[model samples]
Target: MVARRRHRLIQRRKMLGFSQEQLAHQIGVERSTVVRWESGEREPRPWQRPRLADVLEVSLEEVDELLAAQVNEEPEAERLDFAMRNPAAVDLVTVAHLAQRVQQLNAQYDAAPSASLLADAGHCHSQVTLLRGFAPNGRIRRELCVSTAESAILMGQLVWDASQRRDHAVSVQYFDQAISAAREIRDPILEAHAQLRKGFVALYGTKTPKEGLRLCNETAIVGRAGSNVLSGLGFLHVGEAYAMLGERHDCERALGAAEESFARIHNDDEALHMFSPTQFDRLAGSCYLFLGVNDKAEQILTRSARSLVRWKKSQSIVLSNLTLAYIRQGKLEEACGTLHEAIDLIAETRGGGGLNTAFTAGREMSPWRHEPWVQEISDRLFALMTT
Candidate 1:
């Protein structure tokens, strides 16, 4: 009998695109029991009627009506009454029913606007409430079945939020959570993503490129087969990290790896949408420029600046890097112009943290730190940093 009920429940849930864990939360049952029921190993007792009906969004009469309509049978009403009379059972049913309702409402709002354009704002609010009601360290500790892809997307949004607020701690915490979730799902692609984001946090938020390189290397390893774009990005990050460490050989090798990876990429993959071959060339050029290879750097940086005008989101970092290249070539006037454009883009988007970008640009400009032209840009940037 338990097997029949579980099968029916599973069918109903699949029609709704809900996972077993989601249904369990809705019906106030252990996920294990939900699994067992679907597997035909156990049955819900008569006492679980109210909660089950509530979760299914049907009335007791409606349930009876459906059952009778289908098979000309009736449940033993006396047994249900006996089970319903038990306070513990009744409380369990009530809680289960409430949880189901909350889950349903959350789904509805998730599908349609509840007064906001961002569906996650509503979800975030509801999740906070649901999280508060769960037992501390209980089976329902967190929302189960949140996939690695979903976690990465949410973490990216949180990172954007942290940058806007200048909350490095929050950004790091979110990245950590994203990494943990990715690992749990055993998705190498997402694991690489989490590591890359964490590396960004270290490089921009904390000025710790050494730590950032460690994270980037890990990303490159996991991302090699998962997505070439991310793998190439990881190599680029390692190159920057090595540049900061003044390890010219390591920097050159990392940059060469990035270039090769970029060259090998096919046009069919969607993961490359965030970056392009031009961006990769620019990244390589920027590293060369920083290592004092002025002519090679100019060739790469100029191409990057030209391509970046079309990729607005990347302009802040690209322009900043190009400004360094200009400085290295002794074109102080052009470098200042590029700096102004970068500052404007950073201010307009306010996406990547401005202070973080400025600090990196400042560090790259350290070779000419004493030069009046370099100091002039640094002074303006430093003033912005304090404000």
Candidate 2:
């Protein structure tokens, strides 16, 4: 017999755009194991439920509801719409549903065009904001506030990227709003991240390293109270800001502080997911490049490029920097070859950061524009621009 609980579970997974294999990969289970779970032949272990809950964007209790037999009830969407229309009726369940929707949208942001996600993301943010105003209980209100901050951060990233980093003021406004919500909730980690994003704008968008240094320092200080992932991340950028100012000694000192912070990050740290193994090398390489240490930059970026397999957007940026490192050292052929790899990633992800960096690397290779390989890359760049 087909279990009703299995049907609901399958339905929920599909509605959130997760195929069986995709969901299985996310939860670190075999496809066969996922099939057995959906067949109601087994239950996830207690230790596994948290990760499962995170992937499904539901609470542990709700994961149980999906595993057990159930009674007749309104579809979550119908109930959510009613709750949204009557905000005083909002509850934890409704808040959870909204949060899940945001997660679904965010999952697509890295791989999809920012313009494509803006309408749905904006609508969802509006609904969350409306519900936050009239949420019935303190607990419910707090949940909505968290959702607001999360959605606001996503909006800031999407808006900035969609504008090709041109709309700095608007994106900073969104980040500031997110910081306000985080502070109201007494969440230092959230506030620190929001500040760090603003630092990115100042450093890259406006080309102002002084302001970037101030904001990233603040993030590093606040993140220290939480986990080292954010603190290390803050100091990594701190080094970059110093490099932009052409202060090599200060940059290296900040990099040492960042490494020290990273050493303290344990497996169980809550912010571990925010870090990647190649991150330190990637930023350090870029810092050295800015400081005119091309040989050192090439060494670090080469290692980082080899290690970067995930986070394709970041991988592309690293490749672009690697290309620059090659060009500066008179390795024109190697530079062009590295750029091809970066361009492939840029084509796949359409990430603004990598796209911009790739162009910068292209401009630096102008001395050898007569070569066939150089012409080939220029053609690809033209196509990338039009598309």
The TM-score leader among the candidates is 2
Off by over 4 Å in 1: 1-166, 267-270, 353-355, 358-387
Model 2 TM = 0.83
Candidate 1 per-residue lDDT, tens place, 183-266, comes to 655666666777888887776667788899999998888889677878888999899888777788999899889878777777
Clash pairs detected, candidate 2: none
C-alpha lDDT of residue 266 in model 1: 77
Kindly state the number of residue pairs that clash in model 1.
Answer: 1
Error of 1 at 84 (Å): 26
- Clash pairs, candidate 1, are 2-43
What residue runs in model 2 are displaced by over 4 Å at the alpha carbon? Answer: 1-70
lDDT of each: 0.60, 0.86
Minimal lDDT window, size 10, model 2: 2-11
